[model samples]
Target: MPAEKINNSNQAVAHSFAFVACVTCAVSTAHAQSSVNLYGEIDAGLAYFSNIGGHASYQATSGLVDGSFWGLQGTEDLGNGNKAIFRLESGFSTTTGESLDDHPHYVGLANDSFGTLTLGHQYDLIHDYFAPFTLTGGAGGTAFAHPFDNDNANNTYLASNSVKYVSPTLSGFSAAALYAFSNDAGQFANNRLYNFAANYQNGPFTAGAAYLHANGRGNTAGGAFEPVLLPGANRDVFNASVAKQNTYATGASYVIGDLTLAAAWSRSTFSGVTDADSGAVEPSAGFSNYEVSGVYQLMPSLVLAAMYTYTKGSSAHWHQGGVQADYVFSKRADVYLEAVYQSASSGAPAIINSADPSSSRNQLLIGTGLRAHF
Candidate 1:
């Protein structure tokens, strides 16, 4: 072949190779597109309690209203409107820098039309669906909780070894389901849990409900609901192992101009209760809670809220009332002040959600806190 012809052939081969490399790089960039984000929120404050184990107390507090937590969340675009997502969240005490519980630690897939599914440690249906209508970590946090948070209206627990599914919102409606494994051989039902929930929101109106069932809750370490429910000594819930627990809750809210009104109800039943250490079977117990709350947007960046709850139990009962004021300095920071009063039935100790039991049947708490998001 002539020299010119040979050079032309070599240049043709090089152009072909370059074209293939460019196409490969373009495809790789499209398919491998992904993103990850680190996110967190912190709440710290000081509180005064009128009665805690018989004495007035003042102390530093963390998560006085909203729990302090940090987490990472990410998503990878997978073609055809599908994506891969994951989140890992952990709670901690701001006062002492101690680690608390964890949640939403799972990986899953999401689609624009379908929805989301995740596996691992996560919240139950009640917290996802119904708790929003109450003051659960919203306008009023710890101050608005029911007696001992018996109904989990304040999100006191998380399930491990779990699988969760959430449906996409359609016409202002959504649904969810979750199941947690016991993870113990030969004991499939021990400490296992299943939950279902549905919610709807349309403009100024919103409604939701949820149901949760657990067998032998707090009975096994390798199961859901391992840690005891509350932090108080009053109803023995902190010291009791529930053989079976069932909770049902529903709520709704309506927004009118700058004021919002809300109402909610929940029932919790405990059967075959046993002492955690002594293993002594105790009588069955039940709790019914009814709550009404309202929030007023005093200004664009400031809000005032109030709530009242009445809890009736098989053995004891409580009445709780609270008020809160919050001012947002910016999109990432806020300050709040709250006051709460709780009174228990005769002969029953008053137990605030995040505070120790009062020696008598009445308790009061006043607090102020600041929260920042990043």
Candidate 2:
């Protein structure tokens, strides 16, 4: 145990400690390369509905134009041009402080060159591709959806237990598709959906088309929509379990200077609709909607927009119009004012977003709101 022996032992121990520290630092750096982000929006507003039960009423509203929700999104770099990604979003009412039953949650794998594949509760191709050109899908928000949201352009329902694929853009063109399982052990078709879409964007012009088919519309155990749970008045409009629902849509948009113009068309058909109570098949029905919208930038912080839609059925027709003004307080916050009017030539009551039906065949609604994003 001489001094030289002690010094040699100390140097060996120092080397071992240095090695451990280097390894720890390397591991921490690798972990830090992967990142997660939290983002969301909360929109609240005041709304006035005219002709609701023959009386005008005012109430606090949430997500009138855009849904209010909070979400977490993450991406992990797996190296070799691949990554893992995920998102979870929840919707809530600002007035009642209640949760919205339908929201989007998803996890996925992506490749910079190959494409992206995701699974969970999510929107189909219609909502992603063609809906963007429609007022509801664009900036018009929740209240701008077509009658009944029959075409799902406003994301009225999310396809659960779903698998989706989105291809990378090629020469300004991209495509996406999705399929949802019924999740019923013995009934593969009990509640299933499949959809596909393609889009193209070149400079200031954009266009897209989508198609969707679903079976067992009201089978809660396997389906996303519970038509029977709708309000009594609007319930009958979709109460029956539709054996099959087919929807098709196409949309186009163009930007000229400070003005943007858009147009869209959608058709929906239901076959073998059955009474939820009696389980009796009812007659088939269908509807078609045509819409046009325009948005103009009054200034860098102010914008104005207008939209009109015409819906037609075998015996029903509706004419709807909307106008909106928005002013930006900041990049993450804004205030908006909107007015909507609808005229119907049908015995069915006029309803918007599950609110009470108009006492007559015509209805008008006005709203002012604020939205913040983070």
Best by the lDDT measure: 1
Give, for candidate 1, the lowest lDDT window spanning 10 residues: 229-238
TM-score of candidate 2 to 2 decimals:
0.92
lDDT tens digits, residues 216-292, model 1?
Answer: 88889889886464422344436778888899999999999999999999999988788888888778878899999
Query: What lDDT score belongs to each candidate, Candidate 1 first?
Result: 0.87, 0.84
lDDT of 2 at 66: 78
lDDT score, residue 197, model 2?
A: 94
RMSD to the native, candidate 1? 3.7
lDDT of 2: 0.84
Error of 1 at 42 (Å): 1.4
Over 4 Å off, model 1: 1-32, 227-237
